[model samples]
Target: MNGATTSGELRAHNRVRLLRAVHDGGATSTRSHLTRELRLARGTASVLVAGLAEDELLHEEPAQEHGRGRPTQVPGPHPRGPLALAADVREDAWELAACELGGRVTVLDVRPHDGTAEGALVPLGETIAAHTSRLGHRVIGVGVALAGPVRFGGLADIAHLGWRSVDVPALLGLPLRPAHGAGGGGATLGNDTAFAALAEARRGRLRDVRVGLHLHVDFDLGGVLVVDGRPLGGASGTGAEFGHMPLEGGDRPCMCGATGCWGMDVGANALLRHAGLEYGGGRGREQAERVLATSEQAVAACAAALGRGVAALVNAHDPEVVTLSGHGPELAERAGETLLRACEPRLMAIRRDHPPRIEGSALGWRGALLGAMESVFDVFLTPEGLGRWRDNHPDQGRDTPGRRNVTHSTPKGDQPP
Candidate 1:
């Protein structure tokens, strides 16, 4: 149990919700705008705002909109309290960032290390602790975004890392709380690409789109399908391993133990190879950029590979939009014309009228971090958690925003890793 609740606890919960709403909604919405967005009354919104302001979870200011009637104030980024963390583990490097719950991000630290060993996680944990030490005790949970396929809740295997059966939970030494058989704060892990898709869906390109595809092309190409705004994790959570799909008779081998896989044909490594470059240590990055810079040949190869893969998907699922995250978006912009050209022929000719919209990510790299943060928040900010908090702190529950009990379902939003 979380002790006892008071009117103060109620206020805190509502404030968190309001701040989350603003973050999820992208740009800050006005108090009235938030009321409409969250379906709360103006008075209730005001109460929520006042409470958040008291906790410093939100900042409010008088609105300057040229209108009559009662003047309304807009809620802005919170000045302090509670921060979210995001970690990006690429082939030979990692980048971690601290994002305020309001969505502003600060690159906490970036380290170049061979992620091939499970021992690599120790330094990462230390880095995160050092980075957040300045924030006092507000750090809640850590969100990790890995470069390869993360299986289940404990293992992550990526050939680039030469890590098979790596115990992620143990390596990170993440603070583990006793399982209460219910909701509480704990370490949350997400595939980098999946995290990216979540970020894009919630805060980036697919924000309002009902159904879409988010493809992240890194060392390993990964993707996820979103229907009605929620990612289809399928049964095993490895639902969109687009890179592993065979590319007909291609010769190259993939890290996922498959020959002629799409990643062998379309991922960053493929792009690097196309440009006659080697992997490891920024060389591939420089080359990938060069390939995208010199000519559309390398990019065209990627597009063709992606188009074939997409055609198969479109023929089957028929998403409304396809938002490209990571290198996918950058490739689209640099070699978009080629991608479109390649896609045209591969797409279903019969349904030419409704081709999926393919575009770059709106949030760029920030998408992954933001999405990871959201995942962490979901653990402690759910209806159940609020109920627990209320039970422990009864007095705090009365002033809090009342749960509508009515379930309003919206499509899953976008995210990137």
Candidate 2:
């Protein structure tokens, strides 16, 4: 039999559990609530909170007394706690945000960029550097959501932007600063649609789903399969290329070098095409809105295609739920019945009796940014990571924002290799 758990080991485990509870609870988590949620005795909860407070991972303030009950303390992220920087790179624009432990994101910057993928990196790097300089040692990691298929830690293709087999790290100048985990706070890059799906799984409508699919209809339709609250990636880390699949039989060649790609008939570009407007990267969204405002026929056609493709995917994946992000929610609202009708014919007869629940995403366009923060926090909020954080702040009494000093150390066995 294994030996009894040591005090240090137990403390480490409690720290991880407490931090996770606070993170999942958002800004409303209180010390009393954590005690109940983690099922920890009052004394144990006090010890964990004290330890975390000393390490500057979290802090507490007295909650507002609403009724006759005694006032309790509300737990929140330490003002000096580590922040995760998130970047969302779209076809013609990009945004960066700073995320706290409780999922509160503050937009650091948003800027439109030229369609040239290589040239856009200069400004992107500059913006990241500027933000890092302001946050100093509080930055834990950087997570980037790219609007393309990511393979081998780089972009495999983004035809709308004319990018193919691009080295993302080299382009974005990763490792902009030192971080808690390995590789020196190196950036984690993922497909935007995949990350958005991850966001839905964690905190959106798909939270209750065991198996689900999430689609984001932006300039084009892109999505991923979520299993067990995680987005599934293939061997090349780009398996969720649902948009590239051929669902609409046609002779029109797609930017992905395919004929009849489902995305060609289902996204903003598709809507623009139905409106008799030429495809334009920067103007696709605008033209789609214009079409939706004026033409019912275009909306019905796009919604039908969207539903038909979703039915095909549902047949293949057999998901319990389907969530839409980006412009998908709007499109669904306008053509809900029409979309459902289209799905009925395409779905198997048995599935037609009880189809999956389709709904709009709660995170909206913020899904990718929120998911990026999730990627970083997954690295930072572990037992080993908390231990390292404690070790770095040897003088636990120092509570000021700029007083702490960070040092690099090899990650422990519990950490990702």
- The alpha-carbon deviation from the true structure for residue 290 of candidate 2, after best TM-score superposition, in angstroms, is 1.9
Q: Would you estimate the TM-scores of all the predictions?
A: 0.82, 0.90
- Measured with C-alpha atoms, the lDDT of residue 297 in candidate 2 is 87
Model 1's TM-score against the true structure: 0.82
Find the candidate with the highest TM-score and give its number: 2
**Can you tell me which runs of candidate 1 are displaced by over 4 Å?**
1-17, 65-69, 175-182, 247-251, 280-283, 383-417
* lDDT, model 2: 0.80
Error of 1 at 253 (Å): 2.8
Whole-model lDDT for model 1 versus the true structure? Answer: 0.65
The lDDT for every candidate, in the order shown, is 0.65, 0.80
